[model samples]
Target: MHEWADFSVEEAGGRTTVVVTGPLLVSTIAYLDDDLRDLEGPVQFVDISAASPIDTVGAWVIYRFAAEHNAEVLGASEQAEVLLEAVEESASTADVAPRRGWFWQRVPAEVGAMVFELGRSMRRNLGFMGAIIAALLMLFRHPGRFRVRALVRQMELVGVTSLPIIGLMSFLVGIVIAQQGAIQLREFGAEIYTINLTGRISLRELGILMTAIMVAGRSGSAFAAQIGTMQLTEEIDAMRTIGVAPVEALVIPRVLAAMLMMPLLGFYAAVTAIIGGAVISQVQLGIPFLTFLSRIQEVVPVTDLWVGLVKAPVFGLIIALSGCYQGMQVRGNAEEVGLRTTRAVVQAIFMVIVLDAFFAVFFTEIGWG
Candidate 1:
């Protein structure tokens, strides 16, 4: 018998019996552990009829002792038997090994998975582009299918309403450029050349690029979220069910609006930036407005304006397509909508920059530099 528990061993008819008593709980687990460890010799059976309120910890201790001794349990109540069975099942589960590949072997597996994912993404985007193109062709064939009212509304939403913020951003960018150019040119005794710097940079690069980026962040994300929400609510599915093409109805208006308005926005941005540059030149470089205008006329050619203008519709198309594609890709829930919206903006901006770089290289090689 142990001091902490009513445990004893008895022999009857050459069979050894171990009796357990008292509460088998967390508080007495340590005592149970010590008693269990002291138990030696072959035990045929363990009696737990006297044990009260057995728990998982005590069940585990008693079960392990019986397993090691090849002993069967005797006189256990229903609660004790349930706990012991649970412990036995848990022990069996714990014996299984966790799966983990070696580091060198995992590298190729991870790389292959990434490649497969990339391939799938490319195929999906290509299919989406084909669908959009087909929808546009169908609309062209059936001119009456065009939704003029929706297009106008989207134009107002994507273009006109975006003017103030885009104008302000471009204006501030122009001022900063003029100020920086003045400082740099003044060091070389050529402060008047700030007009040339601001005009060339704003018309050739900054104006349309910044406008595209802004639209991607603003209207592109809105398109994604709107379409994604519609998809989540099954409105998109309903449209298809009612013999309405979702791409023609939902995507075309936004795409056309972006394409039609982006060039206007870019032109507005360029003009606003030039005005801001002229203001800065007047204040900081002591150049009059007419002189600044004349300098821009002389230094910045018409081709520079054309370069920025040409990029506008392409950027708009990229933004709209990316937005609508990601929106269509949305599945399952609200969280997916938010995630895809963010991805749309990011992808649109990235593609815009990449296309801009290509244009820059092409134009420079063709003597537009």
Candidate 2:
């Protein structure tokens, strides 16, 4: 027989009663916690008197149940109190907050909650930065354990596997850019300049941006999923409990691998996109291959390539950082792995675009293309 069943909380007259029947297990305690989250109002008192055979798990269940619902434990048994004490200690260590409601509050709680969350995010980032520094220091001490073969695998997966998709995407992008430029330039009888426009814009900006976005979705999410799974399985914790540092074991290799590969991928993407543009110019504008290539050379310079190449590492760093950070933060089970994976992709993509914009503005001012 499993522990805990038909768990319900109800109010009668002046007392609140939490009823549970059966032998509660760890899973049941987690379920009870969900039930506790649903409660409302200012509780005058709580009656856990009907609960039976309240062992350690049962005691944590009852304590969390009451604490989350703002209920006071009334007429508790000595065993129950002991159980509550242990649970409370754990909860305190976890930084769990008891439910508290304002009495006829003037300000809306949601607005305050938003500010609170923002502050919490800032704090989390600070903590993560400290952890990162510590991880880096640990990695510096022991450099040999990081597997070059695993890094090569990561590089292939993140960089090489993304080629076909990026090729097709950039090809379509080149077509669209050329079509749009041809339309406008043809009106001005400047159709020949379409080669110049496509090559310049693509090599300098769109190539890097598109490649970064693609990698964030593919490689970034994979990093998070891999590390998060390791975390969920306690492999990360096991590493730390031994002499190995979790960050050294997991993070540095991924970061370095991504940094090394993303630029190569970006270069491949740029070349393919230029090739894509050449195909369109060859077919649509009746321009010869040599003529299109000459025009691209005339307009796009070495600085254009340099600008895009330099941004690749930044984008790679952003993706790797977000992925490894989210991965390390994962808790519980597979659900957390999925959640952190989504978060890594989303945050990495957003940061990539933002950084792309920064690069764009800087390159424009510097006359890179």
Candidate 3:
């Protein structure tokens, strides 16, 4: 069924009339545009009356032809006339959308957008920190408003439930460090220094760092998911309506729990790691386990233990704040809950690592290395 469009030029009284024939819809007139554009028609009028059931595409082609030849469109029915007029009006000189630029041009624009987003994120985080501080002040003024039960529950979740996994990770990491250190130091006939490497690294850095990473992955993600779900269900909105501050009811307890438990957890991880190091030293280096433990006391300073404890609470604060802030930012749909939860975990871990680096530099300068 070929109902393709066709046009015939007829000359009458020194005038050219293009008699358009066949169905004038898009599918029929597909090749008509090139034919119309290439046509040189100083001779005349476009007569579309002979055309059957003309659509916008046909109208546009005919209108373009008539305009190029300075001829009037004639013999058009009401429908064809309406379409011609509409097409004529829509061929605007103004740009509807900006055209894409070259790759070099796009790169700078993309970089600027990313920098702007980073700045906006920092400002929002700072504002959220202020809100948390203000909520703390409110709770301080009215001590009875504190939710002790929620705080206890969060403590158990973030600390007690997390213990076994944190212990296991630290243990494995200690074994690796001890075994690796012994192998390396054995070349120099200094294999006994494996105890020093294990004890000092675990106490000063690895224990707290690994614990923070785990907590960020676990508790931080949980905070974002829980709060984001609450936001989706309008539970947060309901609390606000009932004159309850979300920060006080939900955030404070989690923040407090993390802050209180992190130091204890970090110390526990360090001790567990030390035990692991002892196990490795006894097996590989032929040192007695009790002797390895006793050596750790002499080689590792009390200052290393203080360093881990000092950093724990600060890391906890950052992780909790990042999670709660991202959770509070969630909006629109159920998919937003997952997105925000992921962002919370990523942001917490990134900030934790960055701050850890800064602390390392600062503490080393202050002779706490």
How close to the true structure is residue 215 of candidate 3, measured as C-alpha lDDT?
97
Kindly indicate the candidate among 1 and 3 with the higher lDDT. Answer: 1
TM-score (all chains, Cα) for each model: 0.75, 0.69, 0.74
Clashing pairs in 1: none
Q: Could you tell me which residue pairs clash in candidate 2?
A: 3-23, 3-24
Most accurate candidate by lDDT: 1
Ranking by lDDT: 1, 3, 2
Highest-TM-score candidate: 1
RMSD of each: 6.7, 9.2, 6.0
Compared with the true structure, what per-residue lDDT tens digits does model 2 show for residues 172-286? Answer: 8988898789989999999988988888778788888899899889889989999999988888878878877676667777888889988888888887777778888888889
Superposition error at 316 for model 1 (Å): 0.5
Candidate 2 global lDDT: 0.80
